[model samples]
Target: MITEQKPLHSGYGPESTAQEIVSDQDLRGKTAIVTGGHGGIGLETTRALVGAGATVIVGARSVDRAREILASLPNVEVIRLDLMDPNSVEAFAKAFMNSGRALDLLILNAGVSFPPELKDARGFDTHFATNYLGHFQLTLRLWEALKRSGNARVVALSSIGHMIGPIDFDDLHFNKRPYDKNISYGESKTACSLFAVELDRRGQEYGVRAFAVHPGAILSGLVRHLSNEDLAEWGVTRNVDGTYTSSGGFKTVEQGAATSVWCAVSPMLNGMGGVYCEDCDIAEVVSADSQLQYGVRPWAIDPTSAKKLWDISVELLNIQKDTIPNVGTNLDSDRLLNVSIEEPVVNGQLSFTR
Candidate 1:
């Protein structure tokens, strides 16, 4: 059975820091991997997990920089990984698989925000390729390691931006439609959520479960693409001291990583998976017309779309995995795209999990 999309009141809130969530727990002997774990909330996540005794491997594009950033930490290893490059992703997965280690936690923590329109080597939109497809490929390639644990969790860092749009199955790469950076980013995030929904459904039977998390808005490198005008419009301001401040609703980097850590290690979520979470708890499902600042949109969690996305992703990657069956027969792209109401006009102040 799928976990209901409702909060259990897990005794954690938006202000809860990642360290606070793991203070009582010990993760000795466990092995985990965090992509882009060298900086931002990913760094805090690595710290908390390592502090709890888990050996963490931080995947980064720059091995030297990652190692330098994490040099003070023990039991943490930094390896090279570039999400835009399929070969890099494959190599990283292969190295881990070679270790014969059981992966207890796999956090899909690396992602790109709104950047200039670009494409990967395969001519796929950079946002979709990097944020969703790359992580999807990595997760599948590590299936054996995850299953070895007999109890493993995979966390996909989704965002509130998912409400901006659902997956445009026919135009994922913006081939037909003119590319709007925010929409592309939103669709990628929605894909992340759907991936978790279907992945949990398939992996739960094998002792591997998946979760999609929305780490509340923190001022991180994710906003580097936004211009000063965009920042001011979003109620953010820069002071003479060169520091930034938000009018409200922004979280500290430590607080932002709490939910991902919680979903990864919290006993409160045992036997539950496939739910989109926020503020350290499973978020409520909000109607498309609702003007809520939080909660997940229905389109992001639709099971049919999730299965269709899985099949589409496999075909795009041209990989064969006999363990999971095909479920994308005669999928109607138009219907799936139209299932959710059009996005509402809002402040566009989305909380990023990366």
Candidate 2:
């Protein structure tokens, strides 16, 4: 089992913001990519990272809007990337690779939630497609760049919703089971945690690491599909006072972005990977009925499950086993120039996993 320990940066809590966590840290030469960087906690994360001297690439489906929002930021660029579209994901990865820039931080922050029943071109449910598969393909496509960085870190934005249930592998796409929007969202988030654990196990020897984060509850564009009635039903908003209620412990956008920035830039987490984190710290393990305060669940941190998820993902994505690069293999400087690249294929269909 991976050790459950606190992060080295000791002073922050659930209320800390991105700026506070990154204080005094200098990312002068680092390169970062944050999906959904145009709004909400994602935007705040970009702002904080850029302010600290990192060159950030903002990925969004709408390039014009993303560019406009990031116009005044130095060393920042916006690229068109729609996680829901396989072709678009491929194009984005190709563009980044062609630039030959190594990435120091990669945050899988873009996701859709609780949408009406729909599936991608590949027939995977929409929530799973965008929230898990899209990021999965993007990470694989950029694996070479990540390995080249020599200390790259990948962060997937998971959520407390994962506590609702473990992944139902047999019916991952809700093909056989009746669909519940909340359950679908939880499954995707659970996949996020599984991905992080597996990625770390596969890449740690190459100086690359991965982490999964639950950014706490916040009102963001992620809730756009929900109406006031839906919000009330979820207890996220109240009708009497017109105020939002805590699904668990509600946080501000900045606070929600704190753990993300910390995972990206903090030297404190230097040698650690594959852990689920929250509130700017490596979360403690908590009971299922433990009020959802802070920390990871046993299922989220289970290595056996994580590896199984990886194998299942490789099979589902039709990624060849031989193509799965050996983790931690020492590479000569020259070999680093030509890292392995895998083509994403799902049963002869060119489909991108979210």
Candidate 3:
């Protein structure tokens, strides 16, 4: 478990925009890659990073489309990357690695929800493959480039949906169990958090840090697959003029991308890693029964589960374990057997203390 999963009381809140977070930060020589960077929350993130002087490479499945969308952003490059296709992922990684440019930030921002039921070529659930495994492979494939930076941060865009449940390892692809779209999405997001936990543990020694961010709920391209009825259930209202209004605590795209930007550039987070964040601050660890929709759940940050998932991912990706540096060979049996989390009341408030 991440012992430091507690809020920093960062002055920024739900309304803070990504642009606001990075407005004064200087990233002049940094290099960043944002998956799905040309659209929605990712587009705002890319804009903010570029505005701060970082040269960003936007990875999109459609190169021309991405270029058209990002043509106005200076210092932003569009590259072909289809997260659902392993071959495409490999090709993209190879191209980036061949450039020999160190990677300073990697934002795994692309994801899907409520899409038609499907599977990738490997027969894995499309949700799991694209949202978690794809980013998992990309991070490992670019490990060398990340290491070259001597100070790199990888942000996995998880969600409050992670509170839905932990990864169902026994039936990750819903092979043996009945498939529920919401459950599948939740599990995939949980995997994103677990990936951050394990990646931070392994990568920290090599100057790489990882964070999982729950960009607040927003009406963005991610909701394209949903019907008007679905949006209505989520508290979206149609105006007289036909413009949609989000009233269920939904944020603007800029606000939605704020946590990712804060994770990437905030000096307040300089020494922290492997923690889940929200609203531009480290999130508290909440119990599964908690009604609050903001904090991270214990299952998402369990070190044992994190490592187990990491190994499973490596096997699924067919990557040689030896190729990855600092891959832990043994798991502490005590830690595995006795995973305990305690929340203490401090100043009349529920505070998680690991």
Candidate 4:
């Protein structure tokens, strides 16, 4: 378990940028996939990773725009992906598998918030579907490639909004309850944290680890739906200064990408998985009454809740019984075992034909 006694670094607060953390690191031959990597913090993340010699794949719903934005980068590729469409996810995974490439880092960073009520192609809540389930499916589909790298890390972007609510299993789709955007987005963010914890629990043994990140607040395209007045009401944007303050504290796009890149490449977190992180280190557990700040919430880090969420995800995605090649024959037993697929010897070279 991660302890709070670890000293905190003050210099790298809300204003730090991604280039600051990766200035001296070498990432040659590493391949990273960043969902929603075309704009905002995602763009900053891709830029930093590419600058450090890593080949970066930017997954976006708008391939043309992503291509145009990242055209100048030498090792960047843009692929089409819409989290709302499972078929799009499946096709993307198939293409990746066909390429026979191994993933060193997977950043599940794409998300939506507080949109008008709508259902996905599968008839599920749009926020929950795009924010959580889409990544869940993508992860499962890419399980083999991730395992092959032998030391892979996945970083899921959660949010401070998770503090607003707990997972509502019975009404996760928000069918019964009134459709409140904040509540729906909150539940999905909470689920993102839980997903990381549970994923680490299952994948740690295979050298695949997972972490959930709260990127801090930044005025990005994510707030396009919210009017200036709406943002001010949430205390996210200051009227006088005409600036945005994150829920915890405002962070630059680079600083927002720091924790994620840290979780991806930092040696300090080796052998540790399933933890929530911020400001380039493992986050501490905060109390219910404690002022909302830089640490993670209790529900976001609860192991029991993580497991429960995993079970529900399995049923919802219909993945409880599916098995990956050479990994195992039955996912039912493996699901219970939570085995890590990143065993060193496998290295993503196993043949699927048994």
Candidate 5:
């Protein structure tokens, strides 16, 4: 069933911090994987989850950097995983699954915005590839671990940037059109939202649920590429005196992580999935002014678009996996879409134990 895309009036708001949400929750034996878990709001998310007693594996492209950021944090392990590299992603997943641990929480919290480049090793657009495809491949690779947990929750860190536009499937790599950083970021984020919906549709029956979250606008490393002029344009509404004030609705790192943490461990959301959440609550649909800032837009959660993006991603991955004939992937999306891809391209011989 589609979860109602409306707020439950969660007692939390934009000012709520990650620690405040999980204060009373005990996650003693829970195991989680947080991509990009070393910096920005991702760091706060890791802190809160670990504080609640969950053993978290931080997937990082730079193991040294992750170690530096998470230095001495108990129950947190830093592993080398690059979202832009498929080989790295597969290797990380195989290592994790073969370790005999079930993943109870998978947070797709790492993403980039306004990158200076257009493509990666595979010639795919970096924003779309990193933000959406990397997470897609990782989740599929770890499906069995999530299923075995019997109560897994996958959270995708979507953004209000999704309101900027929906995805243009044909031009995902900017092959035909000119590349605009803002539009590309928006496309990647929209894909993130769609992935959650489709993932929940397929995984809910296996006791796994997925949700997409808009963490609200926060000053983080995420906007590294935004020039002062770009920042100025974005801050036209708020009093931008060299920094973001509360009037701009910008959140601190702690405040930004509230919704992601909420979606990951909230009992109030039990049995609900495929919803877009903000401010620590399931958001409402935008029914009035198109300029509404809070509610989820119609295009972001459209089931058809979600499935379409899923198909396109599978097709793209199938093509990318073509080079790796040494390993095979368990493309078991067949359960939901009746499309079976036993493509022999993964580096490991691991199987998805459906």
Candidate 6:
């Protein structure tokens, strides 16, 4: 029950770009996994990491689209991963592990926001499954690779939206109550934060660290479900040319990627394990009644709640303590991941878990 919350004032802020964060660092020989690395801030994060000489692996649903964005980037590999499908998540993890590479940085950067009311094949909320559950499973499956890396970091892409979440454990799947898309999205981010808190506690002993990051709002495809008017409702602006013009104060994608890059490679955070970060620095705890949009909420970083979420996730996946196999020492790169997910979500049926 010890606290791992607090800000260190490392001196970076909203204006910092990913390029600035890694200006003084070197990631040569390092290997990283960035989910959704081909899109939005995730793309910028990939650029930063690989620019520093890291070999970056991405779990992408559309390998073609991923290649289209990153074909020119060296040391970048794309594998099939549909975050909405548990089977694809497992295959991606298996493929990555089978490569026999030690994972130095794992950025769980893939996420969805503000989608229409939808449920997974398991009947779990689509936002929750895609944003939280899939990442949780992938991280667990890759735990050994991280530990083998000797000093690894896992950054979970959480958000300020977590402020609206107070997990309804009894009705987590929105089974009993009417569903609210925003609330479900918030709940998913909250789960991401809690996962990092608890994962850090467990993995710190193994030289692996975890962090939850709030990449500032940007007009990424994360909001494709919204229209121009819907975007305006949330302070996002779109131009007539089908591109974002401005967002009340949304950061550029490069700026949006700064905190992740900072958390991944900055020496200032060497001793830190679990913390919620925003604007390129550790965030301060805010009171529930506070009017400010910044700062981390106590509930989002609560250790008790973190443990509860961990247990729930473990149970949902039917994973036993020994389920994580030890395979980081030897990889069979000759094997291939079956890329058979023609449609990740089809006919309102989700087949995420076997």
In terms of lDDT, the best-performing candidate is: 1
lDDT of 4 by residue, 21-113 (tens): 788789999999999887877888889999999999877776787899888888998877777666667666666767789999999988887
* TM-score for each predicted model, relative to the true structure: 0.91, 0.87, 0.89, 0.86, 0.87, 0.90
Q: Write the per-residue lDDT of candidate 6 for residues 1-354, one digit (tens) a residue.
A: 333467777888899999999888789999999998988898999999999889999877777879998999999999878776767776788788888889999999987787778876677788788889989878877877898899999999999998896688998988898988889988989999998888888878777888999988777667766777878877777667667766468888899999999999999888686899999888989997666789888888888999899888877766654453222233222222223424343243222110
Of the two candidates 3 and 6, the one with more favorable TM-score, higher being better, is: 6
Relative to the unseen true structure, what is the C-alpha lDDT of residue 287 in candidate 1, on a scale of 0 to 100? 97
TM-score of 2: 0.87
lDDT of 3 by residue, 1-354 (tens): 233998999999999999999988999999999998988889999999999999999888777878998999899988777676666676677788778899999999987786767777669997898899978877877888788898999999999999889898889998999888889989999999999999999888777899999998887646655678878988886566656787667888889999999999998988679999999999999898777888998999999999999899878877655565563233221122111222211122110000
**CA lDDT, every prediction?**
0.85, 0.79, 0.82, 0.75, 0.81, 0.81
In candidate 2, position 209 carries an lDDT of 91
Tens digits of per-residue lDDT for model 1, 126-192 = 7898889989878877777887898999999999999897899999999999999999999999999
Model 4 local distance difference test score? 0.75
lDDT of 2 at 340: 38
Q: Summing lDDT over every window of 10 consecutive residues in candidate 6, give the lowest-scoring window.
A: 345-354
TM-score for model 6?
Answer: 0.90
What would the TM-score be for candidate 4 when compared with the true structure?
0.86
The runs of at least 3 residues in candidate 6 whose Cα sits more than 4 Å from the true structure, single-residue gaps closed, are 1-4, 227-229, 324-354
Clashing pairs in 6: 86-352, 121-350
Candidate 2 lDDT over 38-89, as tens digits, reads 7888888999999999999988876787888889889888877777666666
| Error at 189, model 5, angstroms | 0.6
